[model samples]
Target chain A: MKVLEQFEFLDDVRRMDARQVIYQFLNFCMIVASALMIWKGLMVITESESPIVVVLSGSMEPAFYRGDLLLLTNHHDEPIRAGEIVVFKIKGRDIPIVHRVIKLHEKEDGTTKFLTKGDNNRVDDRGLYAPGQLWLKREDVVGRARGFLPYVGIVTILMNDYPQLKYAVLGCLGIYVLIHRETN
Target chain B: MAVLTFMCFLSTYYNDDLADVNIKVGSVQVKNVADFTTTRERKDLAIINNLGVKVDLSQVFNWNVKEIFLYLTAEYSSDVNALNQVVLWDKIVMREDAQRIDIPSVDPEYYFFDDSKGLIGNENVTLTLSWNVIPNAGRLPRVQGLGSTTVKLPSTYAHSSGRI
Candidate 1:
């Protein structure tokens, strides 16, 4: 009986005003909703499943490096061309590759066949392709390069390279934001 | 409340933006070139002797020496008659060593293609060169590199010399 009474007393002290708690929860929900909306908006505008990507390798060096952020847009009407850099995912490979289109071979049936070569390597990317898959079709492309920023993705690389650091940073930020909430 | 939410969103976005790096593709130049043409007897199909190829290294940059492994490979379409024929048509043709420079010099004579057996037909050929650039090696983590162009054959036609 005594323990139950103490528990009730602690719960009462910990309970925030209903209005204030509702306000905070609603704000958090709004932020989440807005983020979702923005992502959906990008998907619609770019006509791509993924509008943003990070460079995972140095295959496209001098143009894009590891940790660099890339903006992509895939409009089906826009034909893939030689000399343009692209991000594409190969079968069985989890990460996508960024390389330049060195050759374009169009089949008689209106299907496009293409070859990619890294800007930094000596030859084309046939070795990177799946076994016996000599060419990449239009369906394999994620997006064409629209624009990019330099070295800004290093923090992502650091976080990924050291997951503990990421959790610690996130925890600290969450605590700081909660504890330092403005009373006004 | 709205202001707080906006601030939180902005902070998250800013944090996300700061985590990644950016790299750009600049000019690409051919630094090295190799040609492989061979003829062989195949019971399945007739081979063509007019097989000609060009392998070129365009450019490389922003590489970490420690994180990459550089290898040069050539893959061709398997429809050619000389799929496994070994022919010593040419002696040592071209040889080039990898170097650390803005533009590495690649001699075209150290590499050669043997065409003694028979020429492979309709096979798409591919060549690859890969290398890892070490990070924090005092040198800039980024690099702009080049490769060589194909050497002209006696009977082969020349189209602009493949110069970058």
Candidate 2:
């Protein structure tokens, strides 16, 4: 059976020399490092710490849905405007909320205050802010919504929602990578 | 799959040949409202704006555009603040339905209130229309209107039955 063959392959991998084990480990490390490098490169190009984001909720509705991937950009020169969607994080919250900038208040300083609201909701996002926080400061904004792609980020969302599934996939991938030998 | 997705994302765009837009600001009046945002005793200055706009965005609805977020903004220079842009009104144009929007005369959809209560006799105010084209799989590009108008608020408060 395929399972028996996989077991035999695992046995063969265990019998391999120490150099083979080190080589496989180095290959795995290279894969992880390159993925991190790619992410960092994207961050640098987009001018945002979090260059890519997945839509976790349906607040944006007909335009964006759950599992949709969004590209973000934050420019220092351009101030945020009304009707443009923005992704921001409150002081005490870890999750970022995506909403439209309904109002702008520029202060005596150059910093502009932002009032945001969800398009599908009936009211503004005053309730979503921190207990004492009224307007979002410039630093609170992560980025403005620039590009969108639908339904590709579902794998990540699924993994997040189900820990067992995440572990299972990771375990399977690790085992497969370790057992399979590449022919050069 | 990745190649197809990238192609789909890159295919749609807002026309470089922009659409025509017209904005006219009628009058502005200042009123006092309770400051719900802050505990400051000073009443917030709520300016009532009457505006008229005609937008022909039929060309913006390409094959990939899902909707267009159209809004009218009031930009002015403040003594304390360097620049102030307030959104007075807005509407969503769905691709399946209408594209051109016309308003003979209408009040602002949202309240135009200043936190500092700065506008009382300010003469220099500019009104311009703008839109965000929402595509199915691409970047959201903002487009500015071609025409803008100047508005001057009256010195004193104006009382109307609807507000203020």
Candidate 3:
């Protein structure tokens, strides 16, 4: 009898009205959905697979440093030029590189080949290329750099550096929103 | 709201600065003056020199100009004043509109010439080439405001007797 009474009391306190529960759930979902929409919008406008990137290393130092944010756009019709900095992904590598184009070779079939070298490095990126591959094709390029923000990617870096802190922050935000009970 | 706006503005400002030029050249040279055909079958002149001395700009297809000027300045250790005089003479000759020469190309016509030439055979030879780019009105992406090359020629080329 005592156990049954305790269960009923606990259930009463824990239960929330359906409307209120639905309202909070919808609000959270909307916020997440909007973020995804904006990201997709950026992808379309930039015409790139990844429109935004964060500098994870200092390979492009003096021009771009670690924790910097980069904006990129790729238009297929536009020809790539030498001296311009571009961001590209190598196969099997999770991250991309920002480097300057040092050489370009156009073939008779209208295809183009390119070689890249970082500003701070002593040599070209031949070593970084895929096994036995010497040059980068147009498809390898993710996007050409249109612009960049300095050090604004520090938040991302911090989150990655401190995985525990990232979880703690997310936990705190979730708790705060749940307890505040504000209707928007 | 203020904080969000500030963040947005700061990000944009830094983004612009990050797009600045990052090319470095310890030396540059322009050579191999010969007519050739491009993949497009356009008549173009091939100048093979080492931009690869520091870095090569060969892959860049959206060149703004057809003709590029190669400015040369040579210095002699014996006479500093003579070096200045040579540069001054070359500047005068280069400034004359008639001195500009046309360099043919497949896509667009270009030219190359010395805007200023200084002494040869003393100490060092410094050359600057400013390309005459076809105006694209900034529509082209990442062009970095046309192109310029500076070359330091071999000390032997600075000799007064080396002129052709």
**Please, what are the lDDT tens digits per residue for candidate 2 over residues B1-164?**
77865676667653562677887665556765555545544443656544778988887777777888887887776776667777777777788776778887765666677657566677876778888877777778888888788777666766544334
Q: For model 1 chain A, give the 10-residue run with minimal summed lDDT.
A: A174-183
Docking class of 2: medium
Q: Candidate 3: lDDT over CA atoms?
A: 0.48
lDDT of 1 by residue, B62-139 (tens): 221222223222223232222221110111111132333122223221122322211223223333232323221212
lDDT of 3 by residue, B58-143 (tens): 32222221211221212122221222101100111112133323222112112221212222222243222222111111211322
DockQ, computed on Cα atoms, for candidate 1: 0.05
Candidate 1's error at A153, in angstroms? 1.3
**Best-to-worst DockQ order:** 2, 3, 1
Badly placed stretches (over 4 Å) of model 3 are A1-16, B1-164
Q: Compared with the real two-chain complex, what DockQ does model 2 have?
A: 0.63
Instruction: Compare the candidates by TM-score and give the number of the best one.
Output: 2
Best prediction by lDDT: 2
TM-score of 3: 0.54
lDDT of 2 by residue, A32-150 (tens): 79989999998898788898899899887767889988899988777777778999999788999988887786766678987887777767788899997888888998989998877
